[model samples]
Target: MHTLPGARDTRRAARRVQVRIGGVVQGVGFRPFIYGLARQHGLSGYVLNDGDGVLAEIEGASLDGFLAALRAAPPPLARIERVDVRDIPPDGGKGFEIRETIHRPGHTRMATDAPPCPSCLQELFDPAGRFYLYPFISCTQCGPRLTITRALPFDRANTTMSAFSLCPDCRRDYQAPGNRRFHAETIACASCGPRLSASTDQIASALCDGAIVALKGVGGFHLYCDAGNEAAVRRLRVRKNRPAKPFATLVADLAAAGLVAIVDPLSRRMLERPERPIVLLARRTIVAPSVAPGLRQIGVMLPSAPIHHLLFHALAQEARRRGTSAPACLVATSANRAGMPLITDNGAAHAQLAGLADLIVTHDRDIENGLDDSVMTVIDRAPACLRRARGIVPAPIDLAEDGPPVLAVGAYLKATICIIRGREAFLSQHIGDLDSPQAIRRHADAIRRMTAFLGVVPLVVACDLHPDYPSSRYAQESGMPVLPVQHHLAHLAAVAAERIVRGPYLGLALDGHGHGHDGGNWGGELLHVDGSTWHRLGHLAPVPLPGGDRAAREPWRMGVAVLATLGRGDEAGRRFHTVPQAARLAGLVAGGAFPGTSSMGRLFDAAAALLGICVRQSHEAEAAMALEALATAPRGLVNGYRLNGGTLDFLPLLAALSQPGMDARTGADLFHGTVIAGLSALTASHAARLGVRTVLLAGGCLANRLLADGLAGALRNAGLNPIMPRSVPANDGGLSLGQAAWARLCLKDGTRAGIPGYERT
Candidate 1:
């Protein structure tokens, strides 16, 4: 190997370099790792964290070698995005040391909370260990981060644990350079940490007695009950105002989880991973029916906090005393009213969950940011995040190009905010639907906190085209230049952003509803997206949405409208005889009193209703999911669609569904197959016409495994490459990223072009 003159000079001279390391370097023991690395290389300097990132000044003979090693290997949980090194005059420093964190507002990236590592778990169970029976046991590698952090420069004083000072023994561990707990800000023994009182014991007893217990965890309080207790689960459902939405289960271990749900290798890994998110898996027969209600899949997760483990430990001991297996599972659902923010404070938990929980178990440690457990599921053997929060949030997404500061306020449902600083887009944790006052407040708070922490004032604000959306309203009131992005266009832009494919690509967006540029409701759409501009090439035929939004909640109403659209309005009365409003809805559709929608989601609802799979929806996407579940096998039938000039009609499919002797499952399978065939043909024709090979699939409807997997396979078989979101969600939760990407592209192009509200911005 030949070395350049500059490289040779760098290797030979003793010099000092200022290194700034960015990306997830604040909370995961990065300082300790840096300290160890510097000492190992015989370098003398100090490492400190600031709002921007980790900054270090090292003076050593082998500066180049040190920099190489630092970039190659970091701490187990550290994510190094960029490392900037600059040469400077050598400072006469003797020993490597960890210095106090520098407080710089708006430049630091917050770290996500992590599950307890194996070492910490073992120590938690060891009777002789100093942290035995401690509910808040954590080390440098694990524990709460974003949920407990109030500000940047993540030190103890800036965390919720500041009030609980370290004891003498813990102080020794913190000061010891060689100890793993050295400089671990959250480190504390049972003697000095947040104390666990008799309330936990009472909560455990309540669980054993089939009573709901609201117990505080790392993020927020969770209402828990025995999963096997049907009455208890039902009582909780009635009390919490949740009738049918499935509750997530917290299992003691992998074995316990397997007993309730089918754990494939991939799902098992996700369940045991450090993030410890709730993984939706196929249900077995062990769990009570009421736990998940009408769903065949159950959401299961292992304990993410030491307090949860301690509660399970108490239950296991009691089970051992009785000579039986441990109580392996608990129905752990967020302790909040329907459509409200998660309960974070003890007083709020008690007040809000009064009738729902039989006992309340809490600690003194404050929850700075109330976060719910993240939910994920495997779709086509790939992990898809349903809700991003807790263990999976505050981690920035890297964009292909850096742009000016911008804020993207997400959709009305699954609301989240994205703050773009340079090339990094930091998405806030899930803020949920912006319908309620509390949810809207949470949306505002998240924006304020994220902007204040990141130190970026957005030059441009992006939001949905729907003027009624709370997120859009927030942006309009933000006083910044506002850009209203079409909902489906934003979905396409999000996929492009994640894949870094800036292009004129074919996009298929399928969802329930989005405001179309033509003032119509759009869902199933095909478009040509280039940068910030998109042209609608084709779409599903519009059908009346009987009673408007009411049809979304009642699939039977949509089915009647489908019948009316097919000129078989007489069949609606007999086919939907059980639903009293069927005749009225049919009449309304005939009278043209309802708005028309081209939403693939309403199409799914109609199919489910016509097949009697789901007549009404209790939660979002319930009918669509039930319809997908009924599709047990591929029917290989694809003759039920008509593709005309830029219009794909499914009236033929509705006719087939209304056949007298059609099997419900076969109809569902055929519906899915026909949709796949229709969409693939549509995308292929358009892609060929436009000379594009890549097809992007997005929208909430893509969350359906059958549709996502089937369409991708079909598109590929048709000689077109298909792209979908992997890192971000495909639903409204991911709309913020797309909005931001589109805004950035528009600003880069220097033309208002196709973006809405561009002049206002």
Candidate 2:
């Protein structure tokens, strides 16, 4: 630190400094924040948007101090990526002033969407506020940004909300330099902006009667029902045909939230984080069992939007007036059918949700793009996003190094694409599973719009090695240079990115399915990746998948496939005797009826089917979920399946499948026990073979607590540390980061020998 010469300078001499701030500053009210900071610092200068970030010139008595304050303190929603400053000649004496936005051609940088701001929420409840009760009330600090905007410059005219005209009061607030709403493009009042309408007063009265009303919220309409209403919750479950997947909830405040869910110091802080993501917290016994069903925790969030705030505020006030001890809690799940895009169009909501919803709450501001609320949990004392959406999307992921601009079409399920422009990696919002035509179209549209907005022209395109993936196919058709990334490697790369690891480590990539490098379907794998070079070190034994993809739908086929692969051995042959689907599936497998794949997820489904837990899957992971639900305690001996060099030998495991007298339930229990044993043995073998003591466990299969917990314990007992994603999901949703990391390594020297399994195919 350099100290200025000690001199009595009565007249303050102005000095100017050119500054550049990056990261999530764009579209996040960075310009307004800069303006406020400048005025406060008594600095005279103008701030404007740039291609990669925000740029400003501050001339003041203490330029260095002013720059530091600007970076140290930013609006709640704005995140400073990086701030650079350099001394510049003073621009003469003048008062501090904010300048109009300047458009730089070919500069298309936009920030991600953000949660609703606090001031907007306050005005919603303040009867005299301009936007009292306005569902779409927003300011420079909050409201829709990335999702609703159609183009760059992130102005109202370029957003879906452009349909609504601002009222006089809103215009006044927008033009006021000192107001928080100053230049808030999305600012609007109820009179000339979006309106709130409900089908019946039943809901309106519920809002007034201290009941938690599930209003359709931004990002997507949420299915809101009172949280404490066990019957209402049950009704919601029944109506949505969702039996067990946990639903997110919004509480009146942090105190009220703590009453229903276990809130620790860390969880409490996360609830108050500006992102307003739903935090999965331990459950309180006072809450209804039907809310989460079988799970030990419940997801909770504080009201982020003005409309939500008002509802909770009113509910709390009514509870106070009535002297009731209970506080209102609301279940807020995406308002869409399971495995589909969230409902955003008002007309579509009316047409599709008429039967499911008893009352419908809506607004006039069109949701140009739909996003789901982000879900998170703490892993290793860091906030990890389970489902990154809403406030998180559109914020570019900082790439490790600059590479050829490319588009990485992520895995089929949990489909989200990534665009690499310079050092920024922009992952698209959650696009849902790409099984349906609607989902596929959404994926394409998202790619087009995002690319246009970011103004990045890809020089290369990437896709999963799985040739059958719809996303991969789309990538192939784009007429851009395409690079195929192996599915499991993608998983490893993702873990590496999250850990920011540069060296080789044990990587266990487990998922349902991905096209293997050898043209086989692979799900469970182990690899050692470093700086763009990945080498397969070990993997789970492959199991025959009877009827191929059909077996995934009906898990019983999987059990039969495993039995067939194990050969008609005593335990294996005997275990298939009692299953009804056994005879048919066994016959199919014996006759070489279906394609086979090595997948861990399929194995779980098969185990579930063998246990007679879930014969048919109404949703992806249904059988695996049911299997996890059946686990009572860890009670099994470790067993070893064969490992040929690095590839797992499935022959032994298959010998127990499709036996002469095995019952589904007995087979399931045995399968579960055997898998536990095998995993333990495998971990011990790896520790002995590699002399490495730590392993990273990733992929969608880890979502199965039974598998994750068992595998982790097995690894730990072998004196090895097991790492799992706590901040990022261990699924395809987080695949892009891994893909980007892998690409970074691969593009380094143009070597393709690392993932050698796919070289021939």
Candidate 3:
């Protein structure tokens, strides 16, 4: 190489600039670290904090070196979502400097507070360390963020922790730029920080003995069990009344998880993701079949909380010392019933978890909000949320344009409500099904708390159009101006929110039940959705829903309803002994329930029941799940649906049941094929009518793999694109967002301006 200029010569020509950072940047000491790194690289710059995140500017011979150091070694606990770098005319600065924090709004994006940091973790276990066994050992790097945040510009004064004053030692560390605790937001000692006082050793003893324990964790309470203990798991089931659904498990770490489950690269990344959601992983053969009974995958998550890490670390140590093996896994299920909010109050925990848990390990900190463990799956290395809760939610989804402050009540089951003001949409944690009074109350409280935290007063309310839904009823009771959106339209709105591309796309909404705009039960529907207006272009015929809600519980009723719709005798209905004879007091449903419905879900249920795969459904979507499981192993089944009005005719399939040779399993598969055929036909019709060839599938029924994937594949074969929900759930959890979008459009149109109390009245 030629005698090029030395590296030092290049530095002489470099320029230096000063920058200030804000947002969750303070308690994290991002300034001092930036100063140290700049000095190491012979750079000159200044770093400071305001109310938002950290800000910094650098000048050096190697500009790339400065940028690399900034990104390469970010604080362990400080999660930087965005880094705003702007070029300023350089000053003849000599050296890098770290400066004190300044108060500034809109200067930086505030990051959500993370859990305890590694230094804190080390101190926690060190007997001679200052914070030995301290439950709230936090450095500048970690501890409560949004949970304590009162408002942004995320300074201590704007957080709930503002109530607590700092001690002398802690104050000194916070002021010392060289110390890791410098500018630490929630830094506290054993005497000054949050405390842990146990009432008894009963809970810890129970946990050691492999008993189900209900614990108040960082975000919310969790019902935990040793995954290896079948007896403990069965006990949890009997106590919680959660029988069939697979529970999510918390493994020690990525390595331990890889041992039990087949974690692919994508799934492994999800396990390590900052959100720390339960990753659905395909299981290895080493686990018990009962671990996820009949499931193709198991949900796994890493311990995100410092306390959880400590507990598992101790357990692992004990196992290593004892020279015996113990299950390094624990089921971390929600501490609530199927449709209720998580029990946060200690008294409520004692009452609700007493039966489900042998002992309860709870803390004194009041959980202002009940956030569930976020559940996600990594698809194509992109995060896909199954249940958006802790580490998320209450975290607003930005809008293209702000709306009138509004509270949107989601659909009835798997419900998650959303409250929006400005660019923030504070979505409540998984609020289970909205059928129960307890769930409704929790939904209301979550709404109030989230709205209060965001400092927004909702001027309007949006709700699902299902008039009888408990969520709808609660919206009506609020006495706020209510905007009732059709369930399918809400589904379309949700898709539109994510896509936000263009308007008036054809939306395929396939679900079990939704109140139609024309006052009928609608599930399978095709609609034209623009910015605001939604026109029902085509829908599954309205079928009779005999016994209404009862039909959902017993899918055999759907089969009977379909049979009668096709002119089959009522005598055939008596074959379903699962339904009491009293159900038939209404006689044969001559023209199907509700005249007709193209509901893809009910069609699935009917087919499932007809195939004898699921004659009686004990839980929500039991029939659909069963049908999909059967499809997993095809038993030489062919198509069996009729086409009427260029639509899927479920009646002909029901007529196939009258065939002397067909059995229920065959009947079910035939139904599956039939529904696929109908959906394909429906897609073609909509594409032709709307001149749009793209189909967006939205609904709980779409969660069924057989229908969603099969229909999507079929559509693609017909030269169409089928877009299923990849971000939000296909279920009601997504309905609130959709409802809010539709309401925004309606308010823009002034469609229901004079119709006050329209939903309630």
Candidate 4:
């Protein structure tokens, strides 16, 4: 033992302490790391894994050094959320060691799947190494965790890895404390682990010949094709029934990604996240035109699995062998039909993707949870999440305060669930819309899996106000007490929860659609929220929506409705003669038989239709996205809006776009600028009236970076604090988070039945 400076005997200075660490410390080599750390500090103790997290004891004269090292350095993949130390008498043990995992009743966080670490990549390329060119190379540092996990106490017995018995070489590596794979649940080699059904060379050859391949990944199957081949991309689009929706491109590395998209510092940071989310960046000229049609930005990502590197390596070798250039990137997209959940089953992939994929490249490993790739963008110079899945899900978001467990089932579109336990909220991966039966089943399965893994039995269940939504119905059927929250209020609460706002704050919700508390249709709204109570302050002026929901899909319906509302009913038939329903829609609008919506999304659609930008949409937000991309020079018409007590009207702006010979680019620019100007002024006025200084901006329409950034800047200029959603999405993907926040407050206030003004089904 090392001698202390003041004591001649080392025994006098020796102190033993037990440390309890929580959060993301299981199945990540935490115990092995602690053992190594203790030995380095001349401490004699043992580290063990429990249901709660990692527990360790150290006895040494250099106790301070040992504790400092624990706080300063931990395993790269481990996330130490909290540490609790208790002093104990010296054990006088001889050597440090790792103990067996023990079961306990407590909470533990799940780490999302990560890409291969640098060290693994090095061994993958070295010819002399045993794992050279191995497609399933993994270690404690990086690999599948949440995807392969079945239940908590994340042991090999509870994971998909239990199927493969360790061979001699792998057993040695797993037992050796010095090896990187020591105590790794996913320890394996090519000899005994999962094997690919097809060779890398064959996959590369098929891609080179313009064939779309359905390749299995850690989360789900991905249908990938060569991005440089127009015929291939177009065929994939046609076969997949995705005509104009952009497909994300998977590049070999940062250098190849740079060739296709401009990677700013903000974009690079998100791109480099361990989970490797698909980041939208400025597009260059390296991909096929059809890959991202009519869009100025493109979604780009690096390889997330080992097979991708092996495939790209083969492609590079082929370029040298054939004296030809390889494709810049691969068009990697989720392997699912339109409006369906991602396919994870091998048999299901083979059955469903038969027509879409020319070949299927699969492995034997089972995917316990099917997670789609997460998508991210930059808003206000910060990471704005579009979809939370794969590398982003199953990870807990730290809440501002501790509360009883609550399960929040999200709204209809972009469904997700949140399970709150103590000061942490575990938001599920992006589960597509709850429109289809299969999607609802997926959502239910996700909730079951997440709650089961986290061991959370909620005291109350929360859902959207709309009674008919599948999620709302599910909450009603859940047996637990139901707490219904208003749509827009939940949106505001979500932003506030993320920002941890302390008091009453105003919120601006620029959304596409949400069921209002008054049974009216609302989208563009301003709300004031405080704890368990909230009030609707103001909103955008209402406009007639012909055909109700159908008007969103067919912008021409909105266009004709606007024309009829403007007292030019006869012009609709003449202007949109090509659209068969235009005349009938105009008739309906004239008769005032249609309902009205204060949706900024409908306004965007109306502007697009008037400018002749897009008559019909191929996907959600297609028209709005196209319109935003076309705008170049923005010159908003002066005094083009009207502000009544609480309503901001844009009829004059729509009337301007409805004029004949209005250029699409000029019309788009004017519409965006005017909306920003009008919203800023209205929000500022409300803030002054309410004496509130903080403003929370949320809802789907805020997905528009131009509008989000513009409104944020304007709000700041008005001497107000604007809080935007950072950890969660601004769309319905984040609705459950807000619902969770509000539900927590409602539970605290003894409003378990439901919040005031929100009707319970």
Candidate 5:
């Protein structure tokens, strides 16, 4: 090794060293930042991008200071997961330079897509700028990342941008060290990059004329129509095979969004954030009723791309000429058939959306991966991510400790996968329900893609305990160490993973369905968890599920089951006389040929049916949502309930619902009030016995705003801390996170520790 001349004898000799940094360092201007930092310190070295991460060799008097600064302040978009430093011999290099990218077999972190920066937005509107009115304008701080990247090292050649060469001015900016566009892989100008075509103008005009337009976006294709045009919105909904589900709307800005929805401080901030997720907010009367039928809250979002900005600008100009306000809002729903993967390729979109859309507006840039826009809402005055995708995905979550790599296959609905390497857990984007062949194939593809990108070979495979789940079957078929985790326990663990809560706390797992430890269908469970161990403290009274899965789709059947459970079987047929299966379901309930469940979702279904709100559901959680919407006033005259040894029975509430002359709205309010009062009392009793003060609310049923808000308020008023998920989802979407967390704990505690469901393959 060559040291500084005459400095070898000094206590601190100037020697050369190599450093490798990993985690989310590519496509985020890391090399340019390194160049500026090196020059600032007067170092002689070179930095290059590689499959693993950024590698640099530096020879300087202040090498230690340089390393400290690199860690202390990184780029705004860069996330440093790990740094490895080693000594190296000096090569007597004179100046610092950025070297060519090196491709290898190792793994590296990928950055999520970013929104357009302020500088790019300003330049887009400048008439003299070269990129004025360009839809593909972007810089290092903004534009597509995961959607365009095809391989590691994150260079232009490895991305879809290879088709568009930079113009002379753009090339100069890219090569200049002082410019922000320096080393920006996606940088392009209209002269040499992808150009806007006349078809886009036609599509924009059609949108203004109240016609549905399908436009290709960063992640996938989106169906767009004027939000104020009820006819257009309804037509699009009918064509897409969606009737009651609310469609998310995209507006030009915060002011435009406020005209249709009640935007508070939190909602406005979430809407304006770079991620640009759909934020659920209270709706105003100005919006078309067809946008969100029978719902009080509407999903709202702001434009995140330059193309969206151009469309809004064109609409504004046309509206000004017509002497009216601009068409500031558009229904931006994903362009896909019912229960299928999102359309990514231009040809596929044209083939699938030809009949549904009046015009198609698309581009030539390829989308390497397709993702949906994320969904967010405020729970307990904090932002809760309901669907994690697009601008927020491919980002790793930190764990408490490092362990062996594990792959967790999540639940059947809201499917996702989790890959744990070292102390970072990488989660896949939302994969739809695994009921159809297409959805199942997409789920498998997601696993393969995520594992390949992260370069992880899991030492253990984890999944839910339910044997019928496709995820469980997939894990069983794999020739690896398998671990099955209980469903409710996993839900509690997901919340604990996000909150970093050390257990011994009460957890309420309320959802649609999950296999129970007792071989029964379980939900609405009260559990106490600590580390890898959990104990069921109590649960709601079990009721027969007549006709099995059919009872879940028909709320009237559940109402009849409730009547039978209350020892009023003779009235079941008479109570639901309108339902065709009412008499048969009563006979089935009497014959005892079906399994019983303790599901909170079934309770909501019964209430909705008894009040004549929703007797049959065309989608998941339809009855529950309808019941929540019917509760328009404060809780009125809560009915009585029975708290037995460990089971909370609602027979009294059911009997009250069977009585005549009760208004449907008032009955809905009463049902919600009874549940809140009963559950709160049950929790207070158990918490006092266990001497615990923290309570976690989890599971899919918690998605209802009325229940979550009411339960949180009651828990706080009782002088206890109520914890809800903030980073991960509260639904089955977060199952894999919990499964991975529990698997790590089980591995740490040893295989024969006597945990209930810990079995190694």
Candidate 6:
């Protein structure tokens, strides 16, 4: 190599280049960040938004520094999916500028709303700041995006904020390229932006008096009450018709969060994420017995909106003046009627929540798209999503390969929709169980809204194989080409798609129930999945399921069924002597045939019932959750299970629990351990037989932290790769994504052999 003596280094020479960026770059401070970086590098160019994403052209001697900063440090919320750079002739342009958005046909991503940034928060509490005490404080760095958006090309004209004109000071900030609020669509001051119906002090006073307040939040309305007030929590529960379900509590900051929950490093990082999700953690103290009755963990979140911060600030101030301790936290939950969607309109919040809340604190700003708080918990020593909403909706999962556009209306419970375009799969916010007309309507609405957001019309629709289910019915009526997929297979495909693996792997799905391809109720299954095709390799041992779906509600029925299978049918009546149905169950014809299942979820119910844990589930998966809660130091028994060919049975473990004087906690540990051991052994056998080293664990049963983490650890020790659900939930909430991906794969193959995906081996 030779050094240039009398010549300038061309590498550092001034040059012009055009850069096209994509991904979650729109409405996430990308333009403002570009403006700052260009100015810092003394470049002359203009950056603007377009249907595709952000585009820029810069020319300066420091082009290298500008390009490095652009790719390395974008806005925190901006997820750069692609970057295309090309040399352009320099035109000797003026100073850099943030240009207007170009409206056209293309694709760009929108991120869900986030909490206020550090700079905005500092100004919010500063007396000298113009936005001090403002509940709608925001900047280019953070604020609502997806929830307030109505159409593409995210801008003030395309948002709900268009209803509120910015004040002079705020307008100036928005127009200034160097200002923090520059191009912040939701930016406004107290004088111009929306206002709370009640003052923060009034809300605080009402809370101190043990009153439930329905407060309009970032995405929708939330029912709020003092978490420390036992009477208030119980009253709210009774009024909301949520008898036993736990309520999430919101705090001011990490210090406040630590007061109520055991905040470990991993948990703290989840809490501090800008998306501001509710994290389930072990309770440090019982704030209120009724808040989460019969539960060892509590769901907690930090302030995601300015109003939430204002209320806590006012409460602390009032407590100081009164010489008393302030309420540590507030019980906050979606302000929707049971089994329905969140309330977005003020009139609806008042009309529907009149009886449940004492005060209705609503605003004039409209909520274009409503979402509830995201929920998470630790699994496999990492955070896993329980419910993806609020700050996490509209996050696309990059697909394995490009395919035709497809829409998938999720399962019957925990309904969510997915719209796939090109290579990205856009999953919608949670719409809840489609058991009511209102819920089904909202589910339909979410589908329409998501398609509009993505600007893509699906060419095909996908649904579960169960014809009678609401989602399946909707797909049949959707008028698009329809592809039906099995429930458990969809679960396995979801994890596969998320991991971006097009492979042959072992899939173990342990769910509550799924409509089998052979027209039977299936749950626990072991299969071999190869791309768009799969084969049923094995499953858990089948047991008689009496009363069909009723067995899922009453764990005692499963207990009776298991006893009958173990040649102990005579014990059902004497064991459950208090129940009148017990005698009838014991007297059923010995040779009577009923629908059978290999469901691990039903097995959990059986264990819970025999251990005298939960007789009738007040909530879905209540018995299983209770058993998991009580489990400690699970230890597998030497002869707990038997594996014969493709069928694995746990009759010996059930028999051990049937013995008199077995403690509930001890039985729980035994059940989890035995199940883990049996599954590990069975999976190893199949993996060895099929020569597959990678394993995918799917289904709702994997949501149990004790079982998922333990089983994953055991599988790793067995020298096999085990993957869990990460981008989406392991429950029915994630089913739509799987359905969408499976449909994409089928469309790619386009063969009669791909139909049904499998033929019984």
Among these predictions, the greatest TM-score belongs to 4
Worst ten in a row by lDDT for model 1: 1-10
TM-score of candidate 6 relative to the true fold: 0.94
lDDT of 5 by residue, 1-761 (tens): 22232333324556788999998899999999889887776678999999898999988776766777788889878999889999999887788999999988677889889888898899999999887888888887789998898877789999999988888898999999899899999998878876544444676678878899888898999999998889998999899988888889988899989998999898988998778999999988676798888988889988888888888988887777667776768889999888777888889988999999998777888888888898999887889989888888888787767887888999888988888888878878888788877778878888888887888898777899898888998888887678888888888888887788885899999998888878889988999887677899999998888766787788998888877766677776777777766877777787786788889989888888877788888788889988888887536345468899679988788778777777888888888887887887788888988899899999998888878888888888887788998878899999999898888777877763333444654
TM-score of 1: 0.95
**Model 4: per-residue lDDT, tens digit, 217-295?**
8999999899999999999999999999999999999989899999877788888898789999989987999999999
Model 6: ten consecutive residues of lowest lDDT? 1-10
Off by over 4 Å in 5: 1-15, 61-69, 82-87, 195-199, 567-578, 633-639, 752-761
Off by over 4 Å in 4: 1-14, 89-92, 752-761
In candidate 6, stretches whose alpha carbon ends up further than 4 angstroms from where it belongs are 1-17, 57-65, 87-96, 589-593, 752-761
Tens digits of per-residue lDDT, candidate 6, 348-413, equal: 988999988999998888999988899998888878898889888888888856888889998898
Provide the TM-score for each candidate, comma-separated: 0.95, 0.86, 0.82, 0.97, 0.93, 0.94
Q: In candidate 1, what are the lDDT values of residues 1-761, reduced to their tens digit? A: 22222232434657898999988888899899889888777788999988788999998776666777787788888988789989888877798989888876647677789888888999998999888778888888999999888888899999988989889999998888788888988897778888744555666776888888888888888888989888988999889978788899999889899899999899988898777899999998788888887677899999899878888888887677667766678899988888788888888887788777878778888988988888888875688787778887888777867887889999899998998889888878888889899899989999998888888887689999999999999988988778899999999998888888866798999999999989999999999987656799999999898777888989999889988887888888898898877887787788888888999999999998888888888788888887777787655455688899789998899888977888888988999888889888888888887899988889999878888899988998999999888777899999998998888888877886454455534
Which 10 consecutive residues of model 3 have the lowest summed lDDT?
A: 1-10
Full-model lDDT for every candidate: 0.85, 0.71, 0.68, 0.87, 0.84, 0.87
Order the numbered candidates by lDDT, best leading: 4, 6, 1, 5, 2, 3
Ranking by TM-score: 4, 1, 6, 5, 2, 3
Q: List the residue pairs that clash in candidate 6.
A: none
Tens digit of per-residue lDDT, candidate 3, span 1-761: 11122334453577554444432354456766787677667777777665446767788775556565566667764545456566678776777675655665442444554555667778888999777766667776667665555555555666656666788888888777678876667677866665544422344345557788888777678888778778888778778887777788888778889877998777778787666788877777555555676666788988777667766765665566556675678878888866567777788888777767777777665555566777876432355576777666544565667666677889788888887665545566777876677877887777776665555666678888777888888888888888788888888777676555455577789888888878777888878776666687777766677677788887877777766665554545455655575236225476332455557678777777666677776577877776666554332224454445545555666667546556655655665677777767776876876688767778877666556667777788888877666667677788898877667666666567433653321
RMSD of 6: 3.5
lDDT of 2 by residue, 369-436 (tens): 78888778765445667777877777666656676566788878898888777777787777888988
After superposition, candidate 1 runs with Cα above 4 Å error: 1-14, 62-65, 197-199, 636-638, 753-761
Candidate 2 Cα RMSD after full superposition onto the native fold (Å) = 4.8
How many clashes does each candidate structure show, in the order listed? 5, 24, 27, 0, 0, 0
